[model samples]
Target chain A: MVLASGSMALATRTERTPSLIGSVWRSTVGKKAVMAVTGVIMLAYLVAHMLGNLKVFFGAGEFNHYGAWIRTIGEPFLHHKWFLWIARVVLGSAVVLHGVAAFQLSRRDLAARPAKYAHARRRASYATRTMRWGGVILALFIVWHILDLTTLTVNPNAEEGRPYENLVASFDRPPVTALYIVAMLALGLHIRHGFWSAAQTLGANSPRRDRLFKVLANALALLLTCGFIAVPVGVMTGVVS
Target chain B: MNLTLRIWRQRTADAAGAMTSYEVSGISEDMSFLEMLDHLNEELILAGDEPVAFDHDCREGICGACGMVINGQAHGPERTTTCQLHMRHFADGDTVDVEPWRAAAFPVVKDLVVDRSAFDRVIGSGGYVSVPTGSAPEAHATPVPKPVADLAFEHAECIGCGACVAACPNGSAMLFTSAKVVHLNALPQGAPERESRVLGMVGAMDAEGFGGCTNTGECATACPKGIPLQSIATMNREFLRASLRGGRGA
Candidate 1:
C-alpha cells in the first residue's frame, strides 16, 4: 500500500511540472498575467512611438531622418529595416496575445452575469466601462495607422522615404485628422485605467503604491495623447510644413 | 414609514422570475432591512399570499448567511450586511429594488436567495491547514509574527456572503477567493500547504464558472467587511509564486 501510494504521488508531481505554462494560460489569474505582461510590452512600444512622432516639431529634415534612422537601427549586425521588422513582430505578438486574452475574459465576464439586475445602476468608473470598447477603437486605429504609414497603402501621397510629407498628406485631410484625434483620445482613456490595472494584475500594486500607480497611469495617458495628437495638429496648422 | 418594494420573486429555481411589487407600511426606521422584509412576509401570510423567500440565519451581520442587492447595491448603500442595513437609510415612500446575488456560479435558488455552494467548494479545495486533532496545541509554539497575524486576521474577516461577486460588474469572485487564499497562506501553521493551497483554490475558483477580475474595484467598494482590493493583488503574487515553484503532490 505504501509503495503504490508513493508511486501515485510521484506521478502527480510529474504531471504538474510539465504543464506549468499550459496551466498559467488556462487559469483566469494566469491568463490575466499574460494580458498584463503583453500590455506592458505594448505600452513601452507606444511610449517610444509617441516620442518618435514628436520629432516632427524639428521640421522635415530631422523628422524624415528620424524615420530613416528607425529602419537603420542595429545596422552592423542587422540587415536594413531588420530592427523595424523585429520590433513589428514583437509588437504584433503582444497585440495578438493581449487581444485574445481580453476577448476570452470578456466572453467569460458576460457569461458569468447571465441575469441582469432589475434596477441597473452604473457601477464602475467611465474609464473602466470604456476598456473593452476603447481597446477595439485602438485595434482599428492600429490597422488604419499601419496601412497609412507603414505600407503607405492608404497614404494620400504613398511616399516611401519622405515620412514627414506622408504624415502631412494623411493628416492634411480634416476627416483623417478628426479620426486620429478620436482614436488618440480613446487610447488615452484605455491607458488611464489599463496601466494601473496591469500593475494590479501583475501583483505590483499595494495600499501604499496604489496612489502612485494611479497618478502614473493618468500622467502616461495624458502625455501619450498630447504627444501623438501634436503631430497631426502640427501638420494641420502648417507648422511642420 | 410607507415603502413600495419591488422584490425579485420566483416560485422555483426553474421558474421564470420577475419583479413583484408590494406595498408595505408602518416600517420603523430602527428595523433592519431583513426585519422589514419579515414584516412584509407577515402581512403576505395574513393575506394568504406566498411570502418572499430569502436566505438568513443569524440576524446579526457576522453570520454571512444573509445577502441581497438593495437598490442595485450589494447588501445596501450603507456598506453593511443586509441583516444590519436599517430601514432608516431608505426614505419614506421610496421604491426599493431587492434582488438576489446574481452570478452563474451563484444561481438563484428562490426569491432573493442564491446557492452559494461554489464558495464552499472553493474553501474545501484548500482553505485549511493540516492540523492534527488529538490535543490542543500551545498557541505560542507556532510563533506567527504580529504583522503576519494581523494580515491573516484582516483576510479572515471575509464572511463568504458573496457580496464581492454580486457587486462585480463581471461577476468575478476574485476578492472572495483571494481573501480565503491570503488568510490561510499568511500564518506559519499554513506554511507547509501554502503552494498547493493557492493552486488548488485558484483552480477550483476557475472551474466554478466565475468571471476573471478586471480590477474595476467594484468588489472592494461593495465589500461590507472592508476587505481591501490589495488582497487580490496579494493572491496574484501567491499564485504566480506557486505556479513558478511547483506545488507538492496531490
Candidate 2:
C-alpha cells in the first residue's frame, strides 16, 4: 500500500502540469491580490514622480536640479556606473512587475468571460471599462512627451529657454493640449476608483476606515487630475508660457 | 389610474423573450407595487390567463423576496424595495416598463421572476454565525456598542433582494455579498467565524456565476436599502486579508 501510494505520487509528479497555476491565475482572490499590491506601489511612485515633476514651476535651475536629483537616486556609486545601475535595476523591475501584473489581470479579466464585440452593448460604466482605452492614450502621451522634451529634439525645443517655455510650446497646439486634458480626465477617473480598490485589495480598509479611505482616494485622484489638466489648459490659453 | 407595464416573458432558459405590454386600469395611487401586481393577477385570473409569476412575501419590503427592474431602475425610482414602492409616485396615465433583473447568473424563471437561489447558495456556503440554532446567547450578553450595532443593523437591512445585483452591468452581487459579510462580521459574536464567512461567501458568489465588480458604483445608486458600495470594498479587503493569511479552503 505504501509502495502504491509512493508510485502514485511519483506518477503525478512525473506528469507535472501547471493546472494549479492556471486556476490561481484565474481566481478572483489571486488576481485581486496582484492588483492591490502592484497598484499600491504604482500609486506611491506616482505621488513622488508628480511632486518631482512640479519642480519646473520653480525655475530651470530647480527643474534640472530636480531631474539631476532624480537621476542620482540611480547613480550612488558615482564611478559613473554603479550609482544609476542599481536605480535602473530597481526602477526597471518595478515597472516590469507593475506592467506584468496589470497585463495578466486584464487578460484574465478578458478571458474569464468573453465579450463578443459583435453585439457590443455599451452598458458598462464610463469609468470602469475605459481603463484600457485610457492606458493607451496615456502611453501615447508619454511617448510624445519623452520624444519632444527629452530625446528627439523637436522644432519647438529652445536650447537656452526655460523648461517652462518648452512645456508652453508643447501645449500651444490645441490638439495635443486637448489630448492631454482628456488623458488627465481619464487618469483621474481611473485613480479615483483604483485607490480605495487597491487598499481593499491589500486589506487595508475596515468598516471604520473604508468610507474615509474612499473619500481620501477621491480627493487625491481629483487633485492630481486637476493639477495635470491645469498645465495644458494654461499653456494652450496663454495663461502660462 | 391606468398603468402600462411592459413585462419580459421568456418561455425557457434558451427561449427568446420580449416586452409584452399589459394595461392595468383603476389602480389606486396608494397601492403598493405588489398590491398593484396582485390586481393584475386578479384580472388575469378572471380572464383565465396564467398570472405573472413573481416572488413576494411580507409585502412590507423586509423579505427581499420581491425584485424586478421597474422602468430600467431596480426596485423602481424609489429608494425602497418593490413591495414598498407605492403608486403615489406615478401619475394618472403613467407608463412603466417593468422587467426582471438582467444578469447571466439570475436567469428568468418566468415573467418577473428570477432564480435567486444563487444568493441562497452563496449564503449557505457560510454567511452565518455557525453557532447552533439553540445556542444563541442572551441578546445583551456581549453588550455590543451602539454604533457597531447600528452599522450592523444597516447591513442587516439587506433583505438579500438583489437590487444591487440588478443594477450592476457585470451583474455582480458584491454589494449583496459584502452587506452580508459586514452584517455578521461587524458584531462581536460573528467575529469568530469572520474569516471563513468571507472566504466561503465570496467563493460561493463566484461559483454561482456572478460577474466580478469593477466598481461602477451603480449598485449603490440602485440599492433600495441604500447599501453602500464601500461595504463591497470592505469585503474585498477582508477577502484579501483572509486569503493572504492562508484562510479556509483557499
Candidate 3:
C-alpha cells in the first residue's frame, strides 16, 4: 500500500489538475460568491412573495386562487404541487447554503483575530455592525414563519389548505402582528446591507455606481419592509378584512 | 508631557502576550508617537529592563513598515501611520494602549512587531507586472487616459501596511489585495495578465486565512495611505470578469 501510494504521488507531482470548484469553495472569495448568488436567489423569492402577499387587498377569492395556483403550476406536465415543492426545495437549499457559509466565514473571522482590542473603536455603520445578530433574528423568524403559514402547526387559527384565511388569522392577533413587524424590520436591515454587499461581492460596484447601488439597496429594503408589513397593517386596519 | 502607556509585551512569536504598563515623563508634544516610544524604550534600557520592540523604518510614513494599534485604532487616533502621528494629538498624562497588528496572518513577533511577511507572500502570488527587462519605453507609448492614470495612482498609494487587516473586525485583507489588483489592472501594460493576476492574488489571500470582506469599509477608513474603498469594488469586478472567462476555474 505504501509503495503504491508513493508511486501515485510521484506520478502526479507537478502536473496534477487543479480542482477549480474545490479551490473556489475553499477560498473566502469563493464563499462570498456563493453567498452573493444565494442572496440574489432569496431576494427574487422575496419580491415574488411580496407581490403575492399584496393580492390580499384584492379579496379572499383572488388571494386564495393565487395560493392554489402556485401548487397547481405545471399540473398537466408534472405532478400536482410539484412546482411548489420544487421551489421549496430550491429555496431550502439556498437558505441552508447561505447559513452554513455565513457561519463558517464568521468563525474564520473570529479565529483570525483571537485577541480583542482593549479600546476598539467602531468604523462601520450600525447596520454593518449588527449584521450577525440581524442574521440570527432573520433565521429564527424564518422557522416561526414556516410553522405559522406553511405547516399551520403553531398558528392559532390555522385553516388547512387555506393560505388567505391563515394569513389573516395569524395577523389578526396583535402579538403575532407585532412579532411579524419586528421580523420585517430586521429583514429590512438585513436587506439594506445584504443588497449592497452582494453587489460588491459579485463585482457590480464602481465609484460611479456606488451611490446608485446604495440608493437602490435602501429603496429595496423600504419597499420590501413596507410591502410585507402592509399585510399585517391591512389586517389591523380592517382594510383586507 | 508625561504619559502612561499600556503596550503589548510578547517575548517571542510563540510566547503568550499581555498588556504591560509603563510610565514616561518629560515627553515633548513635538515628538512623534514613535519617538515617545523611543523615550520609553530608552528609559527601559537605562533601567536594565527589556525595551519594547516595535517595527518602524522611514519614519516618514511612506514605507508602510511601521504600524500599531494605538487606543484601539489601526495607526492611532489620526488616519496617519504610527510614525507620522505626532505627540500633540494626545494630552498630558493620557493613557495610551499600543499593540501590534493582531491578525492570524500577522502573528506578533515581539512587543509591537508582527510578522507581516504573509503580505509579501500574497504579493508574490500575482501582485506584480511581468515585463521583460529592456531599455525604457517612450513615456507616452501606453497612452493611459488621465482618469485611468489618476485612479491607478490612487490605488498605487497603498503602502502594503497590514493596518487594513488589523483595523478590520474580521481581519480581512481585501483592501490590500484590491489595491494591488486595481493598481496593476488599470494600466494598459497590465491588460495581458489581468485575469490571472486577480485570480492568483485572491487565491493566495484566502489561503493565508484572512477573513472575508463584509463591506464594513473599515479597511479604507483605517488605511494610512488613504487607499479608497472603491479599489475593493474594482478588484471584485476584475475577479468576476476573470472567473466568467474561465481564467481561474470559477
Candidate 4:
C-alpha cells in the first residue's frame, strides 16, 4: 500500500503542471471572475467620472480647472498629460477585457443550446434579459461620446481646449441630448443588473447579505444614471449655461 | 377533454428531430402530465405506430426522472415537476409543444428522453461522504445546529433534474452543482473533503460544457424543488475559498 501511494505521489510530481492562468481563462468560473474584476474596475471609474462631471455645476472656471488638473496629475514626476494617458490605457484595457469576456461567455452559452425552445418563457427580469443589447448600445455611445467631447470632431461648434464651451455645445442640440439620455438609461439598466451579478460572481453574496447587496446595487444604478443625465439636463434647461 | 400535442420525434442521438403534431381525445383533467402522454402513447401503439418515448419513474416527482420543455417553459407553465403537473392546467382545445431538454451536454436519446449522465458524472466527481460500510453511528455523536441543518436540508432537496439546464438561456448547470456542493459542505461530516469536493465538482461541471451563471435567476424559478438561488452564491464562495487555498492550482 505504501509503495502504491508513493508511486501516485511521484506521478503527480512528475506530471507537467498546467498553466494556472491559462486554465482559469479557459474555465467558465474563471471567465466569470475576470468579468467581475473588470466590471468593478469600470464601476469605480464611473463613480469618479460622475463626480468629475458634477464639477460643472460649480461654474466653468472650476470645471475646466478640474479637467486641466486631471492632465497635470502627478506633475514633476510625470510629463504633461501623462497621467491622463495612463488612465486611458488602464480604463481602455479594462473595457476591452470586460467586453471580450462577456462576448465569449455569451457565445458559449448560445452554443450550448443550439436548438431554440418552442415556447420559452422568461423567468429573469427585464434588465437581465436586455443585458446584451444594453451592452451594445453603451459601446456605441462610448464612441460617440469620445468623438463629441474629446476629439471635437462631432461637435458642430468645436472649441480648442475650451471644456465648458464644448460641453454646452454638445448638449445644446436636441438630437445629441436625446441620444445621451437614451444611452444613460441603458447604462442604468446595465449597472442595475451588472452590480448585483458582479457581487454574486465574486462570492460576496450570502443569504443574510443578499438583500443588502440588492439595495446597494439599485442605489448605485440610480445615482450613476441621474448623475450622468444631470449634465445633459443642465445644458438643455439652461441651468449650466 | 381533447388536446393538441406537438411532440418532438427522434429515432436516435444523431438522427434529426422535428415537431410532429398529434391530437388526443378523452384526456381527463385529473390525469398527470405523464399519464396524458401515456394515453397518447397507448393510442399510437394501437394504431400500428411507434409509441412516443419519455423518461419517468415513481410517477411522483421525487426521482427527477421526468423532464421536458413544455410550451417554452421547463416542466410546463407550473412551478413543479412534469410528473406532478396535471392536465387540469391546460384548457380544452389547447395546443402544447413538448421537446426534450435542449442542451449540448444533454443530447436527446429518443422522443422526449435525453441523456442526463452528465449530472451523474458531476456528482461522481465529489458529491458524497467517504463513509465505509459498517455499523451506524450514534445519532448524537455529531451534533448539528438547527439552522445549519435546515439550510443543508433545503439544498439537499435538489432532485438532480435537468430542468435548470433546460430553463436557462445559456444552459448553465451552476444551480444543480451548487445544490450538491452546499448540501454536503454545510454538514460537519463533509468538512474534511470540502475544498477538494468543490474543486473537483466545478472542474467536472465546466468539462460537461455547461455555461457560467449570469445571475439570471431562472434556474431557481424553474426549479420544481424550490432550491433557492442563494445556493449558487454559496457555492461560489466555497469555490473561491478552495481556489485561494491552491486547490487544482487555481
Candidate 5:
C-alpha cells in the first residue's frame, strides 16, 4: 500500500486553472473594483485639468504658459512632452478599462432582468438613472475635446502653440458653447453618483461615513460643473479673448 | 371593500403569462395581503375556475415564504413581508398589480411563484460553519464580544425572501448574498472558513446569473428584513481581503 501511494504521488501535478488576477477581473465584484480604481484615476485628472483650464481666466499669457509648462514637466529626467504623453496613456487606459467594465456590467444587469414589470414605475434617483447615458456622453465629449484642444484638429482657429487663443476660438460659436454646457452638466451628474459609488465599491463607505461621502460627492460635482461651465460662459461674454 | 387585482397568471414554467384582471369583493381592511389573495382564490375555486397559485407557508411574516411584487414594489409599499402587509393601506376601488419576483436567477414557476432554489445554491456554497459534533459546550466557553454578536444578529435577520432581488432595478443579489456573508463572517464560529466562505459564496452568486450591484440603494430600501446597504460594503471588504490573501487552497 505504501509503494502504491508513493507511485501515485509521482503523477503529474495540476495548477489552479484561473489565476487570482484572472478570477478577479472576471468576477463582477472584482470588475466593479477595477471600475472604482480607474474611475478615481480619471477623476483626479479632471480636477487638475479643470484647475489648469481656470488659468485662462487670468489672461492668454498665463494660460498659454501654464499649458506649455505641463509639456515640460519632469524637465531633466523626462524629455519635452514626455510627461504629457505618459499622462495621456494612463488616462486613456483608465477610460478604456472603465468603459469596458461598465459596458459588460450594464449588459449583465439588463439581461438579469429580462422581463420588465407590467406596472412600470420609475426606479432610482435621476443621477443614478442617467449614469449609462451620461457615461456615453462623457466618452463622446472626450473625443471631441481632444480634437478641439489637444490635437488642434477641429478648432476653427487652430494654432500650434496658443492654447488660450484655441480655447477662445472653440468656445466662440454658440452651438459649440451650448454643447460644452450640456456636456459639463452631464459630467456633473455622472460624478454625483459615481464618487459615492466608488467609495462603496472600495469598501470605504459605512453607515456612519455615508453622509460625509455624499456631501463630498455633491461638492466635487458642483465645483467641477461650475468651474468648467465658467470657461465657455467667459468666452461668450468676451472675457478671455 | 371591493378591489381590482391584475395578477399575473401563468399555467406552468414555460407558459406565457399575463395580467389577468379579477374583481374581489368583501375584502376586510384587517386582512393581510395574502389573506386578500386567499379571498380571491376562494371565489375562483367556488366558481369552478383555476384558483390562483401562490407561495405561502406560515402565513406569518417570519417564514419568508410569501412574496409578490405588489404594484411594482416588492412585498408591497409598506416595507414589510407580503403576509404582514394589511389591506388598510389600500382603498376601495384601487387596482393592485401582483407579479412574481423577476430575476434571471429566479424564474417564475406558476402564478406569483418563482423558483428560488438559486438562493439555496448560494447558501449551500459556504453559508455555514463546520463545528465539531458533540455535546454542546458551556454557554460562555467561547467568548464573543457584545458588539460583534449584535452585528452578526443584525445581518442574521435576513429571511432569504428575495425582496432585494425583486426591488433592485438590475435584479442584483448582492444585498442578499452580502447579508449571508456578513452574518456568518462576523461571528467567531465562522472564522475558520472566513476567506473561503466569501470566495465560495461570491463565486456561486455569479454562477447563478444574478446581476452585479450598482449601489442603487433600492435593495436595502425594499428589504423586509431591513438589512442595511452597508452590509454589501463589508462583504466587499471581506472579498478583497480574501482575494488579496489568495483564497485558493482553502
Candidate 6:
C-alpha cells in the first residue's frame, strides 16, 4: 500500500508543475504579461529580419548572398530546411498567442458595461487602432513572401515574374515591389506601438527613460518604414534594377 | 465658465448610444469636475430627465472610479483624474466633450459606469499574495532599499481606476496590471511567489479581455496615479524570465 501510494504521489507531482501556467493566467495581470513578453520576442525577430532584408538594395548577387547568409545563420542548430521550419514554428506560435490574447481582451472591454463611465477617457493614438488591421495585413504578406521568394513560387493570378538573381527578379515588377513596401509599412506601424509598449507591460517605466522610449519607438518605426519603403521604391523606380 | 457638453446618453445598454449636446451655463472654476457634473445632474433632475451616469467615488482622485473623456482626452486635460480635476483648468464658453471610457473590456454599465469586473477577475486570478494566517512578522524582518520601497509605493498608488485602459490606444490595461505586479512583487515578502505572481497576473490580464499594450504612452498620461508606462516593461521581463525558467523546469 505504501509503495502504491508513493507512485500515485509521484504522478501528482508531475501534474503540479504545469499548473504554474494556469496560476499565472489566473493572476491579476497575467494575461497582459503573456502578450507583452511574446510581443518583445516578435519585435526582436522583426528588427533582425528587416536588417537582413535590406540586402535587396545591394543588387541581385548581394541580395541573394544575404538570403543565403540568412539561411545559414542558424548554422549549428538549423540547416536550411530546419531553420525555415523552426522559424515557422516560433513565429507562428507568437502570432497565435498574440491574436488569442487580443481577441479575448477586446471581448472583455466590450462587456464591461453597466456602472461604467467613471473612467471614460480617450487618450490613445492612431497606431492603436491600426494595430488590429496591421496584423491582418502582415499575415497575408508573410505567406505571399514565402512563396514568392523562399519557394520560388509565383501567384497564378499575378505571375508577372520570377525571383531570379538572389530574389532581385522578385522586385523587378512595380506591383510586387509596391506590395513589399506596403507590407513593410504595415510592419512599421505595428512596431511603433510594440517597442515601448512591451517595456511598459513588463513594468519598467521611469520618467526619463519613458521619454527616451517614445522618441526611440518613433524613430525606429520611421526608420524601418521609410527604409523598407525606400528599398522597394528604389527597385520600382529603376534605381535597383 | 460656460461649457458646451457632449454627453453620451443611452436609456439602457440595450438602447443605442448617442452623443447629445447640452449648454451648461454658469461657471465656477473652483468646483471639482465631478461637482460640475453634479450640477448638471441637478439640472437634469429638475427637468425630470435622467441624470448622466458616470463613475466616481471618494471625489479625491485616488479611487480611479471617475473617468470621462473631456475634449477628446481621458480625464480631461489636467493630467489628473476627473474627480480631482477642477473647473479652473477650463476657460469660459469652452465646449467639453464628455463620454464614457471606451473599451471592450470596460462595457458601459449605465451611462458612465462601466463594468470593470474584468479587472477584478484579473485580480482574482492572482494579483495578490497567497498569505497563510500567521502571527505578524517583524516590520523590519527584511530591510528593503528606500528606492525599491518608493517604487512599490508609487505603483501601489494605482486605485484600479480604468483611466489607463480608457486612455490606451489598444484599450490595454497593461498599465494597471503591471502596476499591481510591480507594487507587490518589489518587496522581499513578495519574492517567493515572484515568478508565479507575475506569470499569473499577466495570464489573468489576457484572459480577462483587455487589449495588448501598443504603448503610445497615453495610458501613463491618463493614469490617475500617474503610473509610468515602464511598469509594463518590467512585468514583461519578469514574465519572460519566469516562462523560460519554467520551460527549463526551473
TM-score of chain A, predicted model 6, versus the true chain A, to 2 decimals: 0.75
Q: lDDT per residue, candidate 4, A27-96, as tens digits?
A: 7877888888888998999999998999999999999889888889999899999999998998888888
Better of 3 and 4 by TM-score: 4
Model 1, span A94-171: residue lDDT tens: 999999999999999999999999899987889999999999999999999999998999999998899989998998
Predicted candidate 4 versus true structure: per-residue lDDT over B1-250, tens digit per residue: 9999999999998999889999999999999999999999999999999999999998888989998889988898899999999999999999999999988889889989999999999999889888878999999999999998998999889998899999888889999999999999999988887977887898899889887788998888899999988788888888777766656422
Task: Give model 3's DockQ, 2 decimals.
Answer: 0.56
Off by over 4 Å in 2: A1-26, A29-33, A58-62, A77-132, A143-174, A196-215, A229-241, B132-146, B248-250
Chain B TM-score per candidate, please.
0.98, 0.92, 0.98, 0.98, 0.98, 0.95
CA-lDDT, candidates in order: 0.92, 0.73, 0.88, 0.89, 0.91, 0.73
Model 4 score (lDDT)? 0.89
Better of 1 and 3 by lDDT: 1
Question: Where does model 5 exceed 4 Å of error?
Answer: A1-17, B248-250
- What is the DockQ score of candidate 6, to 2 decimals? 0.28
- Deviation of model 5 at B156, angstroms: 0.4
- Tens digits of per-residue lDDT, candidate 3, B1-250, equal 9989999999998998899989889999899999999998899999999999988999999999899999998999899999999999999989999988889988888988999888998999889988988999989777999998998899889999889999999899999999999998999888887888888899888888888898999899899888888778778878767766667332
lDDT of 1 by residue, B58-139 (tens): 8888989999999999998998999999999989999999999999999989898899999999999889899888989987
Give the lowest summed-lDDT range of ten residues in model 5 chain B: B241-250
Q: How good is the docking of model 5, as DockQ?
A: 0.70
* After superposition, candidate 1 runs with Cα above 4 Å error: A1-18, B248-250
Tell me the tens digit of each residue's lDDT in model 2 across B85-194: 99999888777877887776778788778888899999997688756676667877789899899989999888888888787766778899999899988898788777
Clashing pairs in 4: A119-B71, A119-B72, A120-B72
Candidates' chain A TM-scores: 0.94, 0.70, 0.91, 0.93, 0.94, 0.75
Q: RMSD in angstroms, all models?
A: 1.9, 5.6, 4.1, 2.7, 1.9, 5.5
What CAPRI grade goes to candidate 2? incorrect
Please give, for residues A37-125, the per-residue lDDT of candidate 2 as tens digits. 66666667667756665665566577666655554554444644465466546655655655566665555444433322111234545
For model 2, state the Cα shift of residue B67 in Å. Answer: 0.9
lDDT against true structure, model 3: 0.88
- The candidate maximizing DockQ is 1
Candidates' TM-scores?
Answer: 0.97, 0.78, 0.92, 0.93, 0.97, 0.74
**Model 5 pairs whose backbones collide:** none
